[model samples]
Target chain A: MTTQEDIRSTTADRHGFSEVGPDDTEAYVELQQSLAFTRLRSRSRRYLVSMAALFLAVFAGIVALMSWTSEPQGGSSVAGIDLTLVLAAGLLVLPCVVTVIHLVYTRRRLDPLAEIVRAQFERSRR
Target chain B: MIFSLIILLVVSRLGRARDTCSDFYVGDRTFTSRQNGLALFGTFTMMTSFVSLSDQIAWHGRRGVLLAAGFAVSWLVTLLLVAEPLRNTGRYTLGDALSLRMRARPVRMAAGTVTLVVSFLYMTIQLVAASNLLALLLGLDGAAARPLIILTIAGLTATTVYYTGMRGTTWTQIINAALLLTAVLVLAGALLVYYRFDVARLFGEAVGGATTSGRDLSGPAPTGHRSPQPLEMSSQVLTVMVGHAVLPYLFIRFLTVPGTRDVRRSVSWAIWLITPYYLLIVLIGFGAAALVRPGGLLASPDQHSPVVALLAVELGGVPMRMFVASVVFTTIVAVTAGLALVTAASFTRDIQLNLTDRRDGGERHEVSVARRAVVVICLLLAGVAILFVDANLTFLMSLDVTMAASSIFPALLFAWFWRRFNTVGALCCLYGGVAVTLALVTFSPAVSGDPLALFPGADFAYLPWRHVGLVSIPASFLLGYLGAVVSSERNDAKYAVMQVRALTGIGAAEAVTTSPALAAADGEPGAPRSRRWLPRQRRQH
Candidate 1:
């Protein structure tokens, strides 16, 4: 199996592009020094999961509040405006919650997506 | 408050580089999608979404969805159509991406002028929004508020230049994204509490009376006028919306990321961020429908709009005020940083890179030039914004983006997908399409009319294809391919092959390449090297 670095090099050579690793970007390096952009290097799975859950909870709360609360000013948007609320609550708002949760989880899981980006950029540069 | 100040101060004191002379623009070119996307979102959450949309609800009632439609689709197009292609094609700045396939110096120059004009005009609009929001929210007068806001904006832009440079912008953007997410949710929650929200009843109330109860209600909206008044709003809305939006902000966001996937994903996330936030605005719009009416179309909603007054003038005092003020402040800060970074990047990566040839310039010199350019660009934007005040030149310039997107975007996409596409055809289609859009919006009443009126058939917006994606985009590509086919130029298989590899990550662009196309020099971190490469023989004796 080719390591990411190997993939990184082969891909870089193909595109007539230059090497750009995480260290290549001053901001990414600096931000990595900071906690915001950096991924959890050695945290227990529990911490990552909890943070993910918290993000989901907050997203859900916002969706619930919007769909459940916030009275309409007056009148139907479509032939039946009530459907919009149901849809917003069920479809729009709920999906939003789910999507956020999914995205957060996927974002965490896809930490290797960075390599993919590195790989892809390397590819594109050629 | 002190926390943020300390952060900035500490970063400034890091002894990295006072001038941000090298790293000020593109950073080290290592940004990822998550980081860059958040930053782009932060920069882009301008008066349009932050202030204007909330007020739009109060102004148009449910009709505001027209604006939402315009905003969402544009972003969608950005994500799906342009993002990866741009990433594959560009390095450094938006202007660089734009001028890549075209060799005509005049074209590059035009693209630069457009970028500068659009960036300043757009930045100015946000500034005005900042000043107005401060006065209305903080109870300051226009005289007191305007200068204070400008100074703060200038200072923030300056400090951004001083620190991690473009990298600083990404960090600031993350902060902004966090703040914005919190603010919009809290406000949404607050509105819910106010209405005691009965999902079905509220809709009933709106349909029955609230939306059109008064003489000012534009006749009975509750009457279920199924077919929008069909005012031919499609084109007009498309024109102004495209005109005012679509340029500097996204292009600026480009420099923050590592590559195309980030451009696509981050932009996609931005759509999610924006859509939900605007849904909150819809929450606010409905909030306004029940609470107040907005006067004057396109007027400063922070004051003139009743939503602002109610949210402030009415109940739930200190917490609301604190939250709103904090959000607005963060919004201003994040947006300012993003704008400053991109402006600097455009100068270095695009204009400077091409003008001086990036290959020979000193990293220190390039960074210094970018830093100075940052100051000048920020000042110029502020001045232009102040001069225009309410003109909303951003709306006009945004038209260029859509024009670029629909016309140029399609051709560029074809260049990626179709091996047959030649540069000559792409240029004709790109330039022709751009010219058509400019003519329609500037010379036609489409610019004058509202794009969000009643119907698409009667769209008065200046853009050639208002809402229908079916026709405008394809025609553009056809024009491009036909132009290329008619000309004697070769298909640039080499360029196409390289682009394919670049996008697929088969090659990392950051790696130094032998391609004459990449003019950025190497060695010594944070040092710009373009000017140093300016053939020494050409220099005056």
Candidate 2:
């Protein structure tokens, strides 16, 4: 039968798990549940889900518009471009703008929480 | 041929310094975000995008724009939900990340199986397409030369992977992406100039030609060739989006970056490039419809050659055609090498290492094993490509995407985000998902009944839908949740640790810093010392 030491060593070797002593496990758990880490994770998840929903809505709208409307008549023109062409181009550019905005907003919101978590982790390690 | 030889030589020379498994597999985590971004771009824009997207657009018209949009949005999903956490896991392979909070052996085995299946299917499609393109370019006819071409491409790809590994592959991908972008931009620019940059006139010409051929430029025509149903379009797009989230090759990209921030930056850069590149693809497709004679283009044996190659020929003649062909060839070579490298890495790191319990193996031994695996996998793929040379490229690719979506994506989502997910759930997700997808696809119209089915002469299909993602994707998620809820083994403590590590780069793998000063300057000495887990090269002293 494998002893406790053997099990710990095997786990460390195979899975790259650091050997966390009994004394450190409590601290590790505390650090994991600390407000900073939780806040960071929750905020990240909220932002990701909201952005995904928004993009999905845009995609659905584009598909609906394409399907519901008839092709633009020959007389319709935006500058030299056809009305249909202009609309399609606008639809295509919309998502890129949204993605950039989401990225910038997410970074601004979450970076501080991440920094706090990092500082907490450093303290726990000490 | 000379270009391939030169690239091989350059890659081999560059790989000489890759003495450790870390270096071979993840570039020792030293690549800048810009370099990784270019590699990511190359990985996403595989040969399928080069060859198949134009044909799809030519066939489907405006509906094909949805497919391109779907491709771009898939990368957005990856950037938002997956990239940062995946990098924070500090794992070299998908199996590494998934097994972090679960029972190692079983989870690793399940992930390994899924990776093998998806990568094998995806690689086979690339190889077959490459072989077909080679035969066409060389003026070879009949079934006899096809196998030879497949073997040649496979052999070349395997050699590149064996010698250069990930580091070499990354640089090669960067170069290939540059060449591919240049080729597409030139073709698109030429076409635009030909139409004098008048979008209205271009569409007008396209509609006229399409009408003459009894088709519609804007939407589905009344002719027998109807547009894809909305559900079908949605299923295809969903499969691609979810598949992008869990593909092993893409996961390997995260490991090449030093931290989560770089991972986010790298994917953002890739999106910035890929978004515009796809827009250009739409232009080129519309240009093909507008500029080429409908009957003439349709009459060509290779449907995409006129759109991709002859358009260049029309403006710059023989020299431009040669340049475009070279670009296509480089793309196929670079992508095949990258795929082979990831497959070998997964097989070695996830399967072989786990099964043998050979953690004691030194860096040299593991590197050797990876090289040997690359050779074996390439040979197997070559044989499979020869057997399935006549398979429809789109069908094969869709099968790959379906498997990825149904098996890997659900499991990865739960593994990364769900606190309640356990090993049993993961197994169910991987095995049940693969079984369900393969069964559904085998009975779907893609395999039979339809004129474009894999075996068109056979009439065994009973399933109404051609693509299986609509049912299989949701089924995998349900089964995974059921398995998790029912299992007796619950490890909330382990999940907490994993969640913390994934959210913050607390215990993620660090870059290999040889300088003691740098290691000292970085706080948390214990975390940096864990580099002992990674086998290092012996010092020359």
Candidate 3:
């Protein structure tokens, strides 16, 4: 039931970014405009897009490969099993592979940048 | 079974003393990452994932395997896109996060309505699946026995959600998830041991059996010799992968943890658990095909789900059957409780509270209404399950996921990331996405035309594809953009605050700590804000 102004004031007071002081609008704008956050945001955005594309590619590739070879009997066999089953097996493992890669990238690249952003926010408050 | 029921009741009883809204909705936000992770695991891996999936694989071959993989892929979607940012923004539900930037009441009403619809559909699906599986387990085939079993399940789900709320539901899910995982591992291990740890042989046997049995081998149809069109398969996969990330029950789990790190940790835990779980499911499905007789495994169309039961009988005997059945029953109850809890939460916290103008003792009133909502929702679920006891509901499950993906997923993404997204845009995304999906589903092969569709007698299906997600998902994102562009409302300042809070979790804790309801319930109306809300261990690091 709070008015728009009340909400804005509350938000500002809660965040209390040091440089922005009591200015609610500037607090968020300033933080977003900071160099560390901008870098982190861009890096995170790139990572997200790439990982998503990679997952879609692998997923689509498996589905396409399976469909292209859907023969009357079994499509083809690797050793004793059908090629469709082998690729489907690959589909089962696809998420695990993608998740591991995501975690590694997040930890190695994104996490450090996020830390920098946090430290910058803290330092500015002082 | 009786013993586990007693334990669940005890946990719920202990939680009943704290009847605050926060406690009811999210266990007062006190669960550790591991606990919430297990709950998330249980919530996502429902009866369909455990029984129906492997059954589909056993009977349908590659199609089933693809579906199972799609389920696991969903966890990855949640991990990458949803968990952390949502955890930072939302206090209880998806509506809370959306309401931060837009007009609160209308957004909540829309989100709550969708949440209720999806939850109801999913709950009914779970209830029917559970009753059927339990009937198969107990060797009960009569119509009379099914209604009885449905009632029992509904009763158990209602008890768990009504008495314990989230606290009780979390504990129940944690227990069931562990047991379900153990059951799958044992079943898979038995299969592996039987094959002398040679997976190639298992696959070989499965392929050989399917060919010799003269079945489709690569598609869902039992008699047809065609693979699903690539578009059809891709659409189904996309439906599950995109849709699952926004399922209200699963999405709400992101809000239960205390902080961002915990959110990431928990989703990570869920992904790790689910990955191996799906891998094992693929094995078990093949094992069922390889080991169980085709006549026994595919006796009736309704008997597709008992592949696991048949496999257990083949592996051990009656004792193994009973053990697997118990695990399935517990899994069903745990997942049902989660659905009920979320449904109730959406009703009271999002719909009712927003629609009304009352602010006095709203927290207590909300908790009261939520409890009643659990009872009402469970009763309705039981009734719908009875009505659809004989119908094929596998389509309904897909529809629920598609609905969530089309509606909530687009709205949440745009709201959190797109600064231009306003109330009008969000409303358009939410309602428009839902409308488009439902319209497509109405005309899709899943509802008619196809022999296995919901209405096989009708032939009005215009949409070639079965799943609506392929079209509706992109349409929703487009609608969001178009809606925003059409509206003059802009909230760059609010978006600034939301972006900062979502990315950094800077002011996120205040949403919880300064909750008017929580403050009143705790008798701390003027409680000073503190950094104690931060994860102490994570902060130290």
Chain B, candidate 3: TM-score: 0.92
CA-only RMSD, every prediction: 12.0, 5.5, 5.5
Kindly indicate the candidate among 1 and 3 with the higher DockQ. Answer: 3
lDDT of 2: 0.73
What are the per-residue Cα lDDT tens digits for candidate 1 across B1-541?
5435843754553334324332455554445566666666676665666666666555555445445544544554454345555665565554455434334343444455555555555567677667666566767775556666666766776676555676566666777788887867866677677667554444454344453444122221212213333233344344333332345556655544554445556776776776677667666655555544323222332233436445543445766765676667767766766667666666565566556555555566667777777778777766765665544343443454446454645555555545455556656655666665565455333344443322324535544332322334455667777876787644242333334333343332341212232223222243222221111111111
- Candidate 1: residue B400 Cα off by (Å): 5.7
RMSD of 1: 12.0
Question: CA lDDT, every prediction?
Answer: 0.51, 0.73, 0.77
lDDT of 2 by residue, A2-120 (tens): 12332233244354433334434454467767787778878888877887788889878877766666563444567765555565665567657776786687578887687777776
Interface RMSD for all numbered candidates: 12.9, 6.0, 5.6
Q: By lDDT, who's the top model here?
A: 3
lDDT tens digits by residue: candidate 2, B485-533: 9996666556666777677766677667646654343222232232322
Ranking by TM-score: 2, 3, 1
Q: Which regions of candidate 3 are displaced past 4 Å?
A: A1-25, A69-83, A115-126, B3-6, B9-13, B218-227, B510-541
Residue pairs clashing in model 2 are: none
- Which candidate wins on TM-score? 2
TM-score of every candidate: 0.67, 0.91, 0.89
Judged by DockQ cut-offs, the docking class of candidate 1 is incorrect
The most accurate candidate by DockQ is 3
